[model samples]
Target: MNISAIDLTIFVFYCLLIMFVGLFVSRTKKGTEKDSKDYFLAGRGLAWWAIGASIIASNISAEQFVGMSGSGYAIGLAMATYEWIAALGLIIVAKFFIPIFLEKKIFTMPQFLEERFDKRVKTVMAIFWLAVFIFINLTSILYLGALTIEKIMGFPMIFGIIGLAIFAGIYSIYGGLKAVALTDVIQVIFLVGGGLITTYIALNLLGEGDGAIQGFSNLYTKTQDKFHLILDKSHPGYKDLPGISVIIGGLWVANLYYWGCNQYIIQRALAAKSVEEAQKGMIFAGFIKLFIPLLVVIPGIAAFALEAPLSKSDEAYPWLLSNLLPVGVKGVAFAALTAAIVSSLASMMNSISTIFTLDIYKPYLRKKANETELVRTGRWASFVSLIIAIAIAPLLSGLDQAFQYIQEFTGFISPGALSIFLAGFFYKRATANGALLAAIGSFVFSGLLKYIQPELPWMDRMGIVFIFCCLTIVISALIEKKGVSEKSINITFDLFKTTKSFNIAACIIIIILAAFYTIWW
Candidate 1:
C-alpha cells in the first residue's frame, strides 16, 4: 500500500505524457462535423490502423491490467478465457457485422435494430444497453481506478475517483471521439510496454525462486484447481466466469454483441478513415489480446508464487508492480497502468456522448440542429456524464467480484443484443417481432440461468438460451409478413477499407504473443 518516491515519479511522468498527447490531439480537432455524420461518426473516414489501435485502447483497460491480472492471481489460466475466446467474435464482426453497419451507415447499434426491426425494439435495446454500459463500465472502472490511486497515494478514494473522472472528461468533452482515439494510441503503447516490463520482471523473479519449470510447477500445484482448463461445478473461485458451457457456447454471442454490435467499442472502427483501416484496427486488437495472458495472467501466477496476498484481489496486480518493479521502470509501469484505466474511461465517455447526441438528442429533441450546435451539445453531454459518473464513483466502491461481476451482469443484455444482430444479418426472414422476441427471450433465459439455479452449468445453460433465442427469431421471422428493407437505410456503406498489411501485422503479433506463453511458460 506504500508507494515509494520511485512509484510517484513514474506515475507522474506517465500522466504528463498522456496529458501531452490529449492536448496535442485537441489542437487540430475540428468541431465542424458539417452534420451528425461528421461529428458523431467522425465523417465515416477512419482508417483501419487508428481504429484498431483505438479498439486495443478501448477494451484493454485496468480491467485487463488490474482486474484480469488479479483474476489470474486468484483463478489462474481460466481467466485467459476472457481474451482468447473473444477472437471468435472479432472475426465474426470483421467479416459480417462490418459490412452490414457500413451498408447501413449506422451511427449507433440501436439504429441498426431500428432499421432491421422497429423504434420500440431499438428504444428498448438502447435504454438497456446505455444503462448497462454506464453502470458496468463505470463500476469496474471506478473500482480499478480507485485501487490504482490507492496504491499510489492512500486516503481520499473520493478525491482520487473525481480527479480521474475530471481528467478523462476533459479530452472526451473537447476532442470527441478523435481525442479518445488519439489518446488511446499512446495509452496502448504505454500499457503494452508497461505490461511487458512487469511480466518480464516477474519472470525473472520466478527464475530467482525454485527456477522456471519448478517455479511454475510449484505455482500450478497450489493454484491447480484455479488453472484447470475445465470448470468445476462447486468451485467458489469461478463465480465470476461463466460455466464451462457458457465459455464454449453462450460466450460467443456475448463477445460478438460486444466487439461487433456494441456502440462504444464499434464506434471507434466506424470512425476509421476507411474500411481497410477499420479492419486493420480490429485485426490489430485481436493480436494484442493474444498477448494479454502473458502480460496479465502469468504475472498473477507469479504474484501468487510470491505469496503476495492483498485484502482485495484487484490489488494483486498493483502489489506485484510495487514489489517487483525497480525504481526507474516503476514510474513508467504505474503510468501505463493508470493510462489503461484513463483510456478506457475516456473512450466510454466519448462513445456515450455520441450515442446520447446522435442517437437520442438529435433524433428526438434537436432534429434540426446544425453540426456546430450538435458538437457543442456533445461536449455538454460528455461533461454531464462525467459529473454523474464521478458522483456515483463512491457508491461503486464496494463491488465484490468486480471484474467477473461486471461481465456477468452485463450478460443480460449482451447475449440478447448479440442474438438480435446476428439474426438481423444472417436471416432475411428475421422480423421486428423476432428481433423484439429474441431480446426479451435471451434476457429472461440468461437471467434465470444466472440467478435461479445457481448450481446449473451457467456457461452451457446460457449457450442453450442463445440457441433457443436464435430459434425463436428464426421461427418468428418466418411466420411474419412485412420485413425491413436494407435499401431504405442510410447506413455508412464502404465505411472502412480493409487493410492487408495491418492484418498481416495483426496476425504476426498474435502469433508472437502466443509464442511468448508457449516458450516462456
Candidate 2:
C-alpha cells in the first residue's frame, strides 16, 4: 500500500484540480442572484454532455467501485445485471419519463408528484427522499469509500469518512448543482480512466504479462462456473439475483425507480437546456453505462482468478490496487476511487439540499421566501445533511455485502413510489388519495414481507410489491369514484420528434446489452 512520491504528487494534484474547477465554475455567473433555479438546478442551462457526464459520475461511486466489485468477487458477472439493465432503463426514462418532467418545469421529484397529486403527497415523498439520501445513499457511499481508503492508503476509517465529506463539500456546498455538474466533467474522466487502468493492470497480471486478451481468457477459464448472467435456485447467489426475474421481474422495478424516478439521477436531465437535450443526455448516459462492467466488475473476476487471499470480498478491489498496480499508476487508481466517492457525495448532498429546500423548506416553512432566502436555506440544508450523514456512516460497517444491502433496503420504497409516479403519468383517474395509499401501503407491505417472508428473493418481492401497489391504487380510485374525467397533466406523446441520432444511439446500446446477455446466458 506504500504510495510512491510520484503517485502521491499525482493524487494531490488531482484533488487540487477538482477543487479549483468546482470553485471556478461556481463563480462564473457574477450578476445572477443565487436563486433557487441557479443553485438547485444549475439555472436549467446544462448542455447534453454536462448532463450525461454528471449522471454517470454521480451514479458511479464506492457503491460500484467497492461494493459491486465486492459482489463481482462473490457472485461473479451476475452482479453486473444492475449496470447492464440500467442502460435499458435510461432509454425508457429518456423516452417516457424525462419529457413529462421537463414539461412540468419541476425541480425536485416530489414537486412533480405534488403537481400531479397534491401538496400532502409532495411533503410525504420529500421527507422519505430526504431520509433515503442521508441515511441509505450518503451513508453507504461514505462507509464504502472509507473502507477502500482505509485498506489502500492506510487511513483510519473515521478520517477517511470525514475527509471525503470535506473534500466533496468544499466545492458543492456553495456552488450547488452548477458546480457539481461542471466539476463532474473532470471527475468522469478520472474515474473511468482510472478504473480502466486498474482493470487492465489486474488482467495483465492474470495473463502473466500476455495482455488483456490473455488475462480475460485466463479469467474465463479459471472462473467459468462463476460467469453466468442469470442464477437459478441451485446457485448459491440465487437469492440475490434470481433467474429470469433479473430481466422481466423485480429488476425492472428497481431500474425504473432509480433511473426514471430517483431525484439525483433525474435532476441532471431536468436541468438540460431542452427536452431534446435531456433525451440526448440520457441516451449518452445509457452508452456510458454499457462499459461500466468492464471498468468496475472485471477486476473482481481477475482477483478471483488470482485467488486473492482476502478475508472479505469487499477487500478484493483494494487488495488488487495495493498489490498489483505500480507506483504512479496506483496513485491514479486511488484518485479515480476518490473521484468516484466524492462525485457521488457531492451529487447526493446537492440532491438532499434540493429536495429539502425546494420541496419542504420553501413550501411549508417560508412560504414567501425570496430567491436569496431560498438559496441560503439550501446551503444550510446541504451542510446539515452532510453532518447527519457523517454521523451515521460509520454504523454501516456492520453490513458485509454493502452492494446488495443498498439494493434490498431501498426496495422498501422504490416500488411504492414508482407506482405513484406511473399511475400519475398514465392514468387520469389516479386520485391523490389512491397515490398516497399506494405509497404508504406498499412501504408497510414491503417491510412486513421482509420480516415474515425473508426467504423470498428481494427482486421478486419488489415485483410483487409493485403489482400490489398498482392494484391498490386502481381499487382506491374506483372506490372513490374518481373518473377518467379528472384532468391530470396533459402528456403530449406527439410533442417530441424523436431524433434519428437518439434512435441510432439507443439501438447501439441495446445491441451491446443484448450481446453481453447472449454471450453470458
Candidate 3:
C-alpha cells in the first residue's frame, strides 16, 4: 500500500478540492440570519442536476464500496440486485412517492406521518428514525469507512473514524443541506471517476494488457460460475438474497424503505425546485445507479480472478487496489473511497441534525424557537451526532458480512415502517390507531420471526412481516368507528402527474432492467 509521490499528490489535490467546494458552498452571499429552510432543505433551490448528483453521492458510501464489494467477492454478480433493484425503486419513488411528499412541503418523513395519522405516530416514527440513524446507519458507515482506510492507508481504526467524522462535520455542521448537496456534486465526480479508473485498471490487468474489453471477457471466462443473477434455494448464498423473490417479493420492501421512506436519501428530492425537477432528478439518479455495480462490484470479481490472498471478502476491494493498481492510480482510487465514505458521513450527519432539530427539538423542547435558533440547534445536533457515531464505530470491528448485518438488522423496522407509509398514502381508511399498531406490531413480529423461523431468509421474513402489518392495520381500521377526515388528508392522487421526460426515462429504465433480468435469467 505504498503510495508514490504522484499518487500522494493526486490524493492531496482531491482532498483540497473537496474542502474548497464544501467551504465555498457554506458561505452566504451576505451576512443574513439563516432560516430553517436555508439550513435544512437547501432553501428549496436545488436544481435537477444538483439533486440527481447529490442523491447518488449521498446514497453511495462505504457500504457500496466496501461492504458491497465484499458481498460481490462472496456472492458474485447476484449481489448486484441491491443496486439494480434500487434503480427501479428510485423511479417508483419519483412517480408515486415524491409528489405527495413535495406537495406537503414537509422537512422530515415523520412530519408527514403526523399530518396523515396522529402526533403519536409522528413521534414514534421520528424517535425510531433518530435512533436508527444514530446507532445503525451512522455507526455502520463510519465503521466501514474506517475499516477501508485502515486497510488501504494503514491508519489505526480509531484515528480513521475520528478523522472521517471531523472531515465530514467541518463543512456540514456550518453549511447544512446546501453545503452537503453542492459539495456532493464534486464528491460524486471523484467517487464515480475514481471508481471507474480502478475498475478499468483491474480489468486491464486481468486481460493482461489487452484492454478493458478483453479484460471483461477474461473475467467472464475465468468466473462464469459467479455470474448468476438468481440463485436456487440450495445455493449457500440463497438465504441472503433468495432468487426470484428479489424481483417480486421482499427486495421491493427493502428498496422502497430505502429510496422512498429513508429521510437522508429522499431529502434531496424534497428540496427540488419543483415536482418535475424532483422526478427528473430521481430518474437521473436511477440511471446513475444502474452503473454502480460496474464500478464497485466488478472490481471484486476482478479480485477473484487475480486470486488475491485476502482473509475476508470485505478486504477484496482494498486488496485489489493495493496489489494491482499502479502508484498514481492508487491515490486516485483511495480518494474515491474516501470521497464515498466522507460524503455519506456528511449526508447522514446533516439528516440526523435535521430530524432532531425539526422533528424532536422544535416540537418538544422549544416549540416557539425562531429560525436563527433552529439553524443553530441543527448545527449543534450535527456535531453531537457525529461524536456518538465516532464513539460507536470501532465496536463494529470483526463483524462478518457487514452488508448483510446492516440489511438484516434494519429489516426489523423497515417492514413496519413501509407498511404504515404505504397504507397512509393509498388507503383513506387507514386510521391513526391502525398505523400505530402496524408500526409497533410489525417490528415486534419481525424480531420474533428471527428466532422462530431462523431458517427463513431475511427477505422472506420481511415480506411476511409486511403482510401481517398491512393486515393488522386494515383489520384495526375496520373495527374502529372513526372515518377518514379532512384533517388527515395531506396526500392526493392528483399530485402524481408525470412529465414526458419522466415517462420516457422511466420506460428506458424499465426496458434496461427487463433486458438484464431476461438475459441473466
lDDT of each: 0.72, 0.91, 0.89
Candidate 3, lDDT over the whole model: 0.89
> lDDT per residue, candidate 2, 1-521, as tens digits?
46788898999999999999999888855676688899989999999999999999999999999988988998999988899999999999998998888888989899888888998888888888888889999999999999998988888899999999999999999999999999999999999999999999988887887898898988999999889999878998899999999999999999999999999899999899999999999898898998999988888888888889988888889888899999899999999999999999999999999999888888888999999999898889999998998899999888777999999989988999999999999888999988899889878889888889989999999999999999998998899996873448676757545789998998999898889999999
How do the candidates rank by lDDT, highest first?
2, 3, 1
Ranking of all predicted structures according to TM-score, beginning with the best and ending with the worst: 2, 3, 1
What TM-score fits each model? Answer: 0.88, 0.98, 0.98
* Greater-lDDT candidate between 1 and 3: 3
TM-score, structure 2 vs. true: 0.98
Error of 3 at 242 (Å): 0.5
Segments in model 1 whose C-alpha atoms lie over 4 Å from true places: 28-35, 209-226, 238-247, 483-521
**RMSD after CA superposition, every candidate:** 3.7, 1.1, 1.3
Regions more than 4 Å wrong, model 3: 488-493
**Candidate 1 lDDT, tens digit per residue, 294-381?**
7778887778778886786777887887677787787778777777888888888777777777678887898898878888888887
